[model samples]
Target: MADDGPDEAGEPEGPDGAAGQPVTPDRLRAFSDGVFAIAATLLILEVKAPAADERVWHALRHEWPALAAYAVTFLVIGIAWIHHHNLFHQVRTVDRGMLLLNLGMLATISFLPLPTATLGGHLRGGDASAAAVFYSVSMAAASAWFTLFWHHLCRRPQLMLPAAREGASRARRNSLLGPVGYAAAALIAPLTPEGSLALSAALVVYFVVGRRAPATRTRVLAE
Candidate 1:
């Protein structure tokens, strides 16, 4: 009778020594948590406190634009982080390019507060052109980061989970919308400040509309 033992072929063992490589979701989770924490904390610094004034209404009125900008940027970043977390949760393996892509994404995330504050300052001061420019640039950088990261995942099928590809593609398109819209906005800034702001408004609508698509909505709900 033949004895059952290690194979002479020397194939690698599975996650539990069963068949294939291990999925390290924990490490991804831990790394994501840290990034999210840092990003969230950075958002607060963009939200300056209202000055003490003779009238509470006056103080709030002065700070309202900044507050609004801070809120919007914070929520957008939070949404991106959630999507990233979900995407990585399904991913099975990591590679060098994936690591670089993630680093680029993190780099963009770390810059969010600067542009948030820039938007806030310009909008509050009634410099529409500056606000539009800042907002557009920030959105463009963010979109580029998302595109690069997703491109890597899409190009390298082995790095992604089977169930996630369709959703990831949809999500990537959604992420790309911001930069494209902002690019349009920036182009119009020189000719029309109002038009540029209108473009910015269009970006918000695009974001909301993208989320409402049945498949993405359903997948988001499932998550």
Candidate 2:
């Protein structure tokens, strides 16, 4: 009934105004959030009660290692979801590169439970250090993937809203802190597991306290 097509007569869409295919990152953000939520929820599976025994309390106490692992990983994933929410809030569009990067990050996020299982099961064994190392290293890899995701956005200034670009460098630096902290923890795991975990907790504190709200955000792409 009506001709619906690109408006050649009007200026381009988006804040950058240099358009290819205008898009909204809403779906990507939503899917990523789902993955994060599922991963966080599944962290608890690492914790299990001891075998059927009359000393129920005593048996449950043996699961403290798993419970500890669950706590750390849960907080880590929870923090990740919050940061991912903030990151996407600045994005208005998605492209092939962005989509691939997002998928890579999500893949690692979804696989987090595997390593969580390993860490929790072995935390009190001879391989405790090894388990901690694996957990920290895996998280470091996830952190790196997330950094690459942000770098993809930084490379394409047009994908983000105007205000986001201005503070992009600062945001990028803040995002790396988690990876750096994880890497450091990985190295320190062999020496002192508690110290390594303490570092991880410190990094979480930094993220929680240092994060700033996005200056502005835009609606999804209508196209």
Candidate 3:
């Protein structure tokens, strides 16, 4: 009979000896990166101009709503990828649970382009309110999944590197900010479509520009 010990092969342990199958985050990250790329690529598909207009340039200019939608979805998904990198950086290994949560997040991410197109098409149409509601609801759901994923990572200290645990507390709380903003946008979407999207966009920009690690690392470390 073989003696089971801490250093045994095939029983690889995490930094904090968190119990789980020994799976690196690289494969998971690679898969997620592909999803993000596809979602971004799909955004441009809805930006086409309407058929047969006398003023070509003017017609092109009229497509601003589609362009705007593409830009907003692009930026939001870009931020999601950044957040994904930051998270997987800390989480050295993964188990079934991590994969499941990440899948949910990716599912929401993959669904973004559809609502983005819908919202853009309806922005200046009679369906604007309905479009705003649909778009905001989709964004809110995606935000929730992203927040849940980050919060799950924060809870598993054993899954994180020693240095990562320091920022875990703030990271958990910050993750919820995006979700709250999205939900607020959803609630107010019927009253004002443009205002709701503008608010959601502001939240996305604030999240990236405000909490960028280089500028804020020392503050978190000092705590």
Candidate 4:
């Protein structure tokens, strides 16, 4: 009978004294990056070009709402991608639960452009309140999913690298701000559509400039 022993590096061997199947976050990160890239690209499609018969400059001038919405949504997604990258930097492996939770997050990301278009279409119309509320709610949903994702990682410390553990508690606390801020924006939408939009933009700025995370080296676990 063969002895089951630790390898030369002193890591315990798996079945047959061989290394276990490697479970790394690389594939998950790749898929997420693709989704983020596609979602960002799709936001541009919401900003349509001027009609052929319309005066180009005049039509573009009137499309300011759409243009503005596109820029804001682009920023939202860009910040989301950056945060996602940062979060995954702490992750060493992914399990089934993590995969499902990540899918929920990506679903919200993919859905943002629809509400963005709706908000842009109605921002100057009588239904601005409805459009703005819908957009705010969508943003809140995305933030909620992100909050849940972070909490999941906090709960499952084994999924994270040892070096990353020190920051997990702070990261979990900070995650709550997203859902709360977006929910506040949603609640205020009925009173002031423009204010809701401004609040949403403000949240993006805060995330970008105020909540910067320290850079971490990506450490992959050996197979």
Instruction: Give each model a TM-score.
Output: 0.72, 0.80, 0.82, 0.83
Write the residue-wise lDDT of candidate 3 on 1-223 in tens digits.
2232433212456788864454467778898999999988998999985677558788778887778778888988987887777777777556556777888889999999999999889989988888988887888888787667666656656666777887778877777877788888888888898887888788877876765642233221111
Best by lDDT: 4
**lDDT against the true structure, each candidate:** 0.63, 0.72, 0.76, 0.79
Candidate 3 wrongly placed segments (more than 4 Å) = 1-22, 50-54, 213-223
Q: Candidate 1 — worst ten consecutive residues by lDDT sum?
A: 1-10
lDDT (Cα, 0-100) at 214 in candidate 3: 28
Instruction: Evaluate model 3: give its lDDT.
Output: 0.76
Q: What residue runs in model 2 are displaced by over 4 Å at the alpha carbon?
A: 1-23, 50-54, 210-223
Question: Which pairs clash in the backbone of model 4?
Answer: none
TM-score of 3: 0.82
Q: How many backbone clashes does every candidate have?
A: 1, 0, 0, 0
Evaluate residue 200 in candidate 4 and report its C-alpha lDDT on the 0 to 100 scale: 89
| Candidate that scores best on TM-score | 4
- The best-first sequence of candidates by TM-score reads 4, 3, 2, 1
**Model 1 C-alpha lDDT per residue in residues 1-223, reported as the tens digit of each score:** 1112222112236568654433254565577668767876787776556656457677667776567666666666766666576667666666555555677777777777887677667763557677667776776777577777776667665556677766666667656776787788778766665566556665665555645632253222222
Report the error of model 2 at residue 174, Å.
1.4
